[model samples]
Target: MSEATASPGLPSRLLADPEMVSACAARDFAQIFQLAKRRGGFHPSRIARACELTPSRVGEVMRGKPKITTMDVIERIADGLRIPGHMLGLADRSWERPAVPEQRQPTAVARPVQEDRPVAAGASGDLDEILAVAAGTRVTPTMLRSLQASIEDYWRHDDEHGGEALRPAVIGQLKYVKGILRDTADPAFRHSLHGIAAELARLTGWTYFDARQHSAARGYFTESLRLAREIDDRPFIANVLACLSLQATYQDKAEDAVTLARAAQDSARLDGGTPRLLAMLYMREAFGHASAHDQAATYEAIGEAQHHFGRIAPSDDDPAWLQYFDHTKLTVDTGIALGQLGDATAAEPLIAEALRAEPTANLRGRAFHTFWLARTQLQGLKVELACTTAGQALDLAAIVESPRVVAHLREFRRSLKPYRHTPAAMELVSRITELGS
Candidate 1:
């Protein structure tokens, strides 16, 4: 028998190997495709068509081309093939392929040995040691305050400096703070750590969201919420809930988005009100309504969000995590809601202002705004501009290793099919389509 026909069947092997079985049962398309292709006999062309992929893509995958197949694409392919979705490795809807572990490089600082002794209760013992360690590592109150100020500055002027430029420093400080928190044993110290973790998670989520790695972003947001809950930090919990609501909206889970947003609002209400959190929750609710095509509800929510946001006082003691909320952020979200509501005309000015207000360094936000602009332009039949904007978004997306950004690009490619005959549009679409290979 020829090698292709002689190979073991996926079903038999799936029953034997736990990993393969688990992967199959989870509807993990990447693993299923890998195993199926290895077994051979099945024609690549047929598989490609079944998966809604181009014939060329089948050849690339069969030939082991250097391409990244997104989990969503794999799920779509599995759906198309009428495979038992659970067998394809989608058991955990939140399952994500872990990022490739980075090689550990030697650090400039000396590493400390892990201690087994439990920290003594109170401000003495381990707490004192932890504080001393933090001080040695320059993680003092002054340092944290300064870092916080820098982060705020970065957010405020991200349009000018570009988001990438601030990432290294922000991540560095976050890592440093995380280490300090993890090594501490005092209840008060742990509480402070929880606050820091929540904030870091938010930043990480934003970074991942910008990169278009929705799954990873969701994971970070989930962790952030967990941290806030551990600390009983009501405002932070509401903020994290708002983040989750946005994720649900983006993934087309409109009802879930609304539910989460309302929950966030209620949580904030119980905490005596946080205008920023309330505004974010209302804005997300508006987006959810827009996604559901409930125009009246969408408009009502948007008005509520705007009124609350306007009521935020400069003198009010807002939580550190809500520092990013501003008029510019509101405009961007409003534009997105308007676009979803099918009011492209109304969305245009707000999107434009958002783009103009966004810092050049905020590459991720720029990419997002540009992508939405492309969507709006495409809906309006401005094919050339849409193509150009999508191309720009693709360029920015490439610089960040984000799955969420990739997903957006994938959707944008789908929306560009009507203009595939146009060279510029087709070229842009081709690049994004190539990702699934």
Candidate 2:
């Protein structure tokens, strides 16, 4: 198409404006979109269409959902908006040439993403949690079940995406559960509500741990333990202990982690531990051992974990929460423990196998397993492969809002210091730095 026939672009004056310049340099698309609207009389829809992005996506960018970072996306924006390559920190785009105007491919307008709480498919999505919370409506068994289902969804999303986004919702649910627990007169209601409260408190605590808010996490975890103890829920007590163990391991309190894991195992044993439960407990212990750099203890705990895991049959009556700790969990966990113990040679294949079994929905889990895989590869001196793997992990981690992933990526970055000059490592280092900034 001739220049005259082409859609008119943003005015050069707008692009040259200091605000525009700063927003571009900072890659603050939110400010950029708002500036375009306020100063250039451009609507988000037009910007989305011009950029081959959905109007909803443009809205999300304006709302600051996720940053536009991938090179392809940045380049596309450069071409679509007629923004100079240098403005986006890229080499000159072909479309910048006078003789080579860019071809703007059309993108289907995406429906705006909804933020409704998760409900089971085909079930009546009739539970108005927001309504109940506001109106102080009497809770029912059905509502409890609904909350349980939603809690499962919370865990699922927490695994897939990071927990930061879900924190508010979970805490709201926790408050609701606890409030109901306080006022309940019926034994059955009290029992059920107590269990739910314990679960919610523990879930909130896990989210705090993921955010690296250790103090907040421990407080919630202690609350969970207290609630479980109130009802003599041995299994739940064990579960909370396992959670605390993992948190302790992350905090570098390896001895405490090991002791907590042992206590969890003891509690599970008192409750006639399911094979899967024992397996998970042992895996927690393995993590503790690995963190302490106790190679012998680490392998022993890993062996025990795998041994128990192998005994788990399809018919076993494990706790609902233990359902998440399946074969895939054990595989990835074993590999991580091994890697942490400096036996990366034996860890890489296991992590890879676990990744293959993982559903794409679990983005954070994939990021985590991929990180271990990359670390193992690096340990084996496969620097380029490690860099590529780490890059993939970071890409998966980027959209997820977990500082835990960021911390892990930082450690990975430090590990790559020796190979910092290599192209792959340099690219990864740059990518990691960009993510931080």
Candidate 3:
């Protein structure tokens, strides 16, 4: 097998040692650090920072006084140290293989995206040459355009098949694009790269949310916001904030949802997004208010959304990302808000209309909207209709791979207890049981 390259100042023998490479790949930091300090002239403090650990902690691990736990910390250390993910028993490193064959770098060097320093703990020789060689593999606008296309393609797949099926691949793509961003130099290109990175992060967050991985989703959303701020991309920031708020709404954190939605709307107003984008934020605010049981505020926000949406025109400057927010989407969101606020009468027709117009390509969305429509049916005491509508959602759920959809179906099953004597309800219950949680 070909040996991995050694960090500057580290002995070639260490990198070549099978045992040492195995320790690093296994994330046995204690063993790796012990060997580094004794045989590689490595500095603990520098390694500590690279791993995002305190020097004392690094020492404790080296001395076997403490064990490094937490997959997050381990992954960070492996990434910061430029340990190939495949070596660490994870996916291939973003640099080891390009996301697309055309974007591959010419050099073998794989640098960390965040830190500019070399991977060596204390190496100090000709760092500029390494960076220059790495930078020579420039990411042009055409390359970024391909990346954007890939992201859109993933979105389509996520819409059809749900996030669980695509999370690993989408995240891998994000990592690869992020690596490219690190090597980019042109100011305009870097700014564009940041925009794409922010969107990728946001998409990753959405996928995590769909998978019911709330903590992971929140982390990615926060990262997206930070990347958006780096480029001062207000529209992207607003969209990310709206996504956070939507997650909060789904989790029943009404106050947090309202606060985040308000922030998103404020961001859009201050930073100048299109009317359609502003409308989408307003609709998000409506959902937050509905979740809070604030009927007055919910309708008011819904009205605002309608007002803003009415201002849209064919000549509007909406980006391609805003294409998902058309009239049908507005109707679906409004119906959801109304349903949440205990207005089944008003919500049912609107939701049904949107569901009817929903294309077959958007299976995940159709499942989601169907759930709301069933909820509205249940609210109206139409148990038979509700059971049938929910059955439709359950059928879709069986095909799509979203934890959120499963969660909704589970909740729907629980709601059927009141109508257990009804044959339709019992039939639906049997189907749900067969589907499994």
Q: State, as a TM-score between 0 and 1, how close model 3 is to the true structure.
A: 0.69
Clash number for each model? 32, 0, 0
Q: Which pairs, if any, clash in model 2?
A: none
Write model 2 residue lDDT over 1-437, tens digit each, in one string: 44335555677999999989999898777888888778776688767655655677678778876566534345546666777878878887665657756797676886676688674445334445555557664765357657878889999889888888998999999998887777666554576678788999999999999999999999999999998888778878999999999999999999999999999999988867878899999999999999999999999999999899889764454556778898899999999999998888899999999999998888888888899999999999999999999999999988778898989999999999999999999999999998888
For residues 1-437, could you state the per-residue lDDT of candidate 3 as single tens digits?
11123462345587567877889767677888877777766678756645545577678778765455434445556554556666567766444565464775577777658677546534445576576566544664346657777888989999999877777887887787788778776554566678778888999999999988899999999999999999777777889999999999989999999899889888877756677998999999999999999999999999999999999865454556778999999999999999998999999999999998989889999999999999999999999999999999998998888889888988988988989999999999899888883
Q: How far is candidate 1 from the true structure (C-alpha RMSD, Å)?
A: 26.1
lDDT of each model, Cα atoms only? Answer: 0.70, 0.84, 0.81
After superposition, the stretches of candidate 3 with alpha carbons farther than 4 Å from their true spots are: 1-136
TM-score of each: 0.59, 0.69, 0.69
Tens-place lDDT digits, model 1, residues 165-202: 55666567667777777666544335555676677777
- Candidate 1 residue-wise lDDT at 22: 68
Of the pair 1 and 3, which is ahead by TM-score?
Answer: 3
Quote the positional error of residue 89 for candidate 1 in Å.
56
